[model samples]
Each structure stands twice: as C-alpha cells, then as structure tokens.
Target: MGDLGLFGPGSVTWKVHAEPILMVAGLRALLLQTLHPRALAGVVQNSDFRVRPWHRLETTVTYVVTVNYGTTADAEEAGRKVRYIHSRLRGVDPRTGEEFRLDDPDLLRWVHVVEQESFLDVARRSGVKLTDAEADEYYREQLRAAELVGLDPATVPSSRAEVAEYYESMQPELATTRDTVESMLFMAVPPMPFGLGWTPLRGAYTGVAALALSMLPTWARQRYGLPGLAVADPAASMAARILRAGIMPIPRRLIEGPIYKAAMARARAAGHAI
Candidate 1:
C-alpha cells in the first residue's frame, strides 16, 4: 500500500503537478467544467457549492493530491469514496430537462479532459519546457486518472491533437449558461478558510481569476462576455517561469504537505530525491 498508486516518482504527472502553476490550471479546469450544463447541473444539485464552495474545491484538490502522492491503499480508498458519492447522485439537466447519472462516462470524460488539458496548458505556458512528445506522454499518463473515475481509458484522448479533436467535437455542446456565470463569479473571490485572513490571499486569487479568463478558449471567452482578446502566449509562459523560479527554490520540507513528503520519502528510498 505504500507503493506509488499508479504514477511512480518519475511519472509525467508528478513532474507537471509538482509545479505551483497547476493551481492556475485547476482554476481553469473548474471554469471549463462548469460550461457543460449537465455536469454543472450535477454539481449544483448534489453539492453544497453554493453555500460552501471552498469545501468542494478542497475535497477535489485533496482527492487529486492523494491519488498523485498517496500510497496505493490511500489512493484506492479515495477513488472508492468518490465512486460511492457519484453513484448516489442523480440530477436533472436544467437546460434539456433530461435526467443524468453523476457517473456517466461522457460527463466523466469531459471532467477528465478539461482538468488534464488545463494542467498541461498551465505547465507549458508557465515555462515547464516539456517537449511535444513529453506533453503527449503526460496526456497518455493522465488516462490513468480517467480510468480511476470509471472511464474507459481507450476512449480518452492521449495526445494534444486528439484533445483538440475532442474539443472540436464538443463545441456544439458547450455554452455559457447561468451556472457557468455563477461559477466564474464565485471563483473570482474563492472562499478561503476562516482564520486565514482573506487579505493575504485576495491579490493572488484575483490574478488567477484574471488569468483564467485571459487563457480561456476564444469562443468560451466570448460567450462569457469577455473580449475574446488573446493574451500573448509568452506572457503566461513568463509568469509561470517567475512563479517556478520563486517557488522551486524553497526546500520541499518547508513548502510541501504530507502527501508530497511521503512521495519524496519513497523517491529517496528508491535512491533519489524528487
């Protein structure tokens, strides 16, 4: 159970996810996921996001970090909990008046792709320097996460080109519904835990929200009433480089939590430090 769950220490997922800029990528993923009416419906109907948004965000982050760095038993237990929760949730899609299960493969695929694509997008733009082949490998590696959510790995996109094709096919189904707008607004000033002063986090989160808007797909931006103005790609890349420079220099023991520390311990035991 102490073994790396699915991705070992050298995995592309580990390499990409270790960067702090993935926080931005995560915000982007949440933004993208809310665009799907059915998926958004499931969230709105089943979760207390409207009243306790940070709880949902924290739970999602915890699950991801656990799978990425936790032991096999920990990862399996986390996935099992998620599956159990999803299995019990059913919601009616407000837009189409159609009922859908939370665990629907199509919905899961949408969530998986948006999240994986966002992680890579932020990593690349922020100066992680992954080659095209490495990026594709990262996507291929991410199929493991999709599978954890009950998706068929074979149907998941495994490369940038395939991801683009998938998005193209999904464009007709994408839109800026009221839920999307609400989610965006909520994310703008994401609820932080009490006792941690908001003043400390407000500026950083505002920048993230702005960047999420700037980096959105043109059509999505326009639908959300953003100008669809493109920020030069290098801008995000440069910002990411600055963030990496600022963060990576800190010793892991000072900045990381238990999950990352355990992963590093495993790496050390395997004869290297991650």
Candidate 2:
C-alpha cells in the first residue's frame, strides 16, 4: 500500500475512499481539542504535524484538496499509490439498504472536504504551523492526482468560500449517511489492538482523553480545573503520567460507543456531519 504512485492504478472510486481517512483523523484531533482543550497534551507533541513528515501531512491534506478540487490535484497529489493486497468486500448502505458505488465522485468530495477542515482546525489548535509556501506546495504536488479524479488544476478554488461553493454544487451526487458510512468502513479503523498490553492501552487512552480535554474552550477548561487558569498544570501532570505508563486504558465501549456516538449524533443533527 506504500509503493504506488499518488493515485495508484485503481478505479477512481478506491482513491476516494482512501483519501479522507487522513482528514478524518486530523479533524477528529482538532474537534477533540477545540471542544476540550486539555486533550492536546496527550496523543500529540509539537513535532507530529511538521512539514518534515510530509507523508503524514499529505494524508491530512488530501481531504482538503478534494474539497477544493473535487479530486486530487495541484497541492494534494503526493502519496497516491498503494500496492498491498486485500480481499474485496461488498459495501452496503445502511440508510437505503443498497450497495454503494466506489466510484462516486460526490461521496469522495464530501468526505474529503469535511475531513480536511477537521484536520486543519485541529492541527492549528495543536500548534502545527504551516507557512503559506508550504500550503501552496501541498496544493501544487496534488495536481496529478486531482486530474485522475476529474478535476482541472486551472479551475481549483483559491479560498475557503470558493471551496464551499464547489462542494454545494456537488450536493446532487452525494450519497446518504448509510452509503457514506459503508464507504468509510472499507477505509482504516483505529490503531488500537485488542488484549495483551492493557497498561499501554490505558496510558494511550488517558493521554488521548487529556489531549481532547485540553482543546476545549476556556470556560470548559475552567470547569475541568485544567491548567493555565485555575489549577496548576493538571493536564501536564496527567500527560507526564501517561508518558511514563506508555499506554492509557480507556474502556473502548465507554469512549467509542457512548461518548463519541452521542457527540456525533448531536453533530449530525446540527448539520455538521463533516
């Protein structure tokens, strides 16, 4: 999965599904921080988002490029190849009880944009500063992939509003939530493993929680008694403990099933599914 060209040799559909995971992870990181503040101190350090890790950054940027271009192009074309083989599986749409088509451009664009915005917001809050030149470079490198997905480099939008307008134009092609989720399921899942290292899991989970908490608004931070306002740096201390322990064990069902589920449901209802 790591050796191919930027768009690989697959049908356009595969690239669509694969491109947004980076954005999803990035956005999730950002929202967790913005809504929780203290969370930032846990999972990431200052170095994780730097330009040096262009491969990692490319994944995150892909979504943004998709949103702006409806395909990979200009600044989002790097890292497009994947040679690892896996079995093909059917994708079912939960909402309509129908199968989702992998080559659907609308679905790809929607997920890409939403995920990119989410990642960008989080990266900024987490202190991953990007220079204008870096941002432009990212866009430039993505041109080839963008063409593969049917986007023209000359037509790419230059600003956020233009990007939003481009997305709105694609509404007719977008799939329902059920279809979108099915597409996402074919993508990657979290990196956590089951069993064998309970201590590391605990440390990681605790660290993630602490980082998410740190991204909350000031008032929210005060409510949690996080550092920089009321108490001495509780967030920092908790982070240190997480580092010493190696992994933080958070009950998976508790964090994912309930907490994350409830928040996402609320977000969807509020018209912010991205």
User: How does model 1 fare in lDDT?
Assistant: 0.82
> How many residue pairs of model 1 clash at the backbone?
1
- The stretch of ten residues in a row with the least summed lDDT in candidate 1 is 228-237
What lDDT is obtained when candidate 2 is compared to the true structure?
0.37
Model 2, runs deviating above 4 Å: 1-90, 131-158, 164-191, 194-197, 209-274
Could you give candidate 2's per-residue lDDT for residues 80-188 as a string of tens digits?
3310110122234433456544333433334334443343333333334455444434444444444444545555543346555765564443332332232222222
Tens-digit lDDT track for model 1 on 191-243?
66675546757777787788876666766777788776566545656766777
TM-score of predicted structure 2:
0.36
